[model samples]
Target: MRGSVEHSWGWGHCAPSPLLLLTLLLFAAPFGLLGEKTRQLLEFDSTNVSDTAAKTPGTPYPPYSLADFSWNNITDSLDPATLSATFQGHPMNDPTRTFANGSLAFRVQAFSRSSRPAQPPRLLHTADTCQLEVALVGASPRGNRSLFGLEVATLGQGPDCPSMQEQHSIDDEYAPAIFQLDQLLWGSLPSGFAQWRPVAYSQKPGGRESALPCLASPLHPALAYPLPQSPIVRAFFGSQNNFCAFNLTFGASTGPGYWDQHYLSW
Candidate 1:
């Protein structure tokens, strides 16, 4: 077509180089919002690890855990039924004994229109269980953001994921299982005791009733510890090898939106 109208009238006599307009505005945005701004520059910052925990002793960080992930320019609207969870400092349904068994798991998997909107650093444990402490009790209740519309993209296919670069095969069966949350036996509970208030969230058990793997409960289990410190327990696991496999898409509201204004703007 005459070289596409002479390449748009020869670039209309030029005027666009700010590195070509910042590489055309970063290829016109959205690789899942640049992978959620590279996960807010790689998430996990529990008060900068408790303000350097007395000059780092065993600081591999991540105690009460927090990674809601919602790059709508910050949104923890605070009213999805607030309760405020706590532990070590008490009141997370306290029955004393420094918090019991502990259970509250909701980080789901189910919403597949063939995997809609998810693809960014779907990380969650694979480096020898970080500290292998079983992170006492269990809970996943904090606004329930739903891992930013979920995604378990196995960066490099499985069989212990060696090489990478396989963007979409729907899922490469939870790949390159590499988890390293550093670990100095991470344990924190200050500031309203971190998180996990409401309870009862279970799924991972493959008994074929439309499975929901790794959320919680399989006869009361949320990973255990605290019975003379020699105690142990693990309930709800279905698809081991460090379970992680995603593609639970659904996220759309870039510029002038609707879908009830991105579902009531919250």
Candidate 2:
């Protein structure tokens, strides 16, 4: 179980339905939206950790960004008019959420046209580069092109391409496969966005040196540099959504010492 990657679907023997199909790993993200205080610890309140909260799809997306918002009655991070996200599996199943007190969370592969009011939410992958604004959530909304990150797998690749490439679905308007995204990077950011000291915590570590789910470790393992991005974001890595259309890229390059894999703690 230490190094295994799970691709199972259909939550608990329930028959596959539109929502179930819509919520598969190829289409889902963990939906662990936590509440205030902890939510506002790094980013602001209200905004999801990804920081792509849009008023109307334009440059300069708004808060939850460190210097920007607050965490009051928060639920979904997607905009019903322009975007939506689905969970790939049940919350407890997301290994990424097992750290900190991110007691809850979800995973997302891509965004989609808002279809919930009329139909099940459609999972939309990029036909081309899905260029939307991005923010280092838990940081100031007006960042100096700041850095954001997540701990990834050690091998620098995953079990397959990002999702089911070219596969259409019942609740999706487009195929949700993000073919180019084979790796995720938080190379040093348990707290650091750009640079942080990597700490080897797990035995037979697979990715860029990480601790195996600490229920309560007295010593913090990672030391982030250039100051931590948002203590708030770190605390809710698994449960809080850490992405958006703006700051996210279709494909990116990982710099030196950066091992980019998708899982947070594998």
Candidate 3:
């Protein structure tokens, strides 16, 4: 006859051994470190738009006109009809990605008029303001069923539009919530985030201006983190992690002037 081995804690029921419990905890530790879900809102790479890369060298920086570049829209899993973008060139659309009901998302890159640039093109201006516009359908039914939040970012140089600024507004009758500018322009990220000042929903589009601590501009290149200052609302917008979903129009303006070497991403 062979003796039987039984495993039990102080209670009558059998329990896992200390070593096994430690192994289970160790296995689960990684999951805790896993971050929250983050959708790639928009990414722009503009390093290849130098004078040397331009089709005609020395003609003028940014060889191709901003209007000549095309937008590569990535609808990865959203209804085509529901999402739309108003850009200069014909957009390259892909319908293969999974769909998220009532949600529309896409991305575009700035390429040369004839061929895609080796890198993303910077929104440089010699005499006029350069702008990009995007629109999304607001959430229906309101409450949790509605879209969670909205976030935007620019990866390249400092304040893509130092002299110009982007405007955001909603069409619904109900006054939409406002997001105050993040205290820190680029919060702990390698990017220089856009600092969006608070503006009343009733105000005319492009009428509001961003409030900064100092008039001096940080000309240096850094990731832009344009998120609200409120901790709770900031997290809600996913600005802390980098993500946003909102229905609004972005208009860039130089106010009858020209900006040199400015940059923008979408």
Q: Please, what is the TM-score per model? A: 0.17, 0.22, 0.21
Cα displacement (angstroms), candidate 2, residue 67, comes to 19
Over the stretch 1-266, how does candidate 2's per-residue lDDT look in tens digits? Answer: 01011122212224343233333322221211111111111111221223342331123222221222222222354333333242212122323432223322222221222122221111222211111111121112222222122222111112221211122234323313211211222223211111111121222232223322111111122223122233333432432232311121111111211123222221
Structural RMSD, model 3: 23.9
Give the TM-score ranking, best first: 2, 3, 1
Please identify model 1 stretches exceeding 4 Å from their true place.
1-102, 106-108, 115-266
Over 1-266, each residue of candidate 3 has an lDDT whose tens digit, in order, gives 00001110111124344333222222211111001111122211222334233221111111111122233332232223322122222212323311112232222111112221121121221111111222222212121111111222222222232222334545322223332222222223322222323221111122223211111122322234332232322322334332222211111111110011111112
Q: Indicate whether candidate 2 or candidate 3 has the larger TM-score.
A: 2
lDDT for each residue of candidate 1 in 130-187, tens digit (9 for 90 to 100): 0000011232222222211222221111232211111223343332222211111101
Alpha carbon lDDT of each predicted model: 0.18, 0.22, 0.21
Question: Distance (Å) between predicted and true CA of 158, model 1?
Answer: 8.4
lDDT score, residue 186, model 3? 26
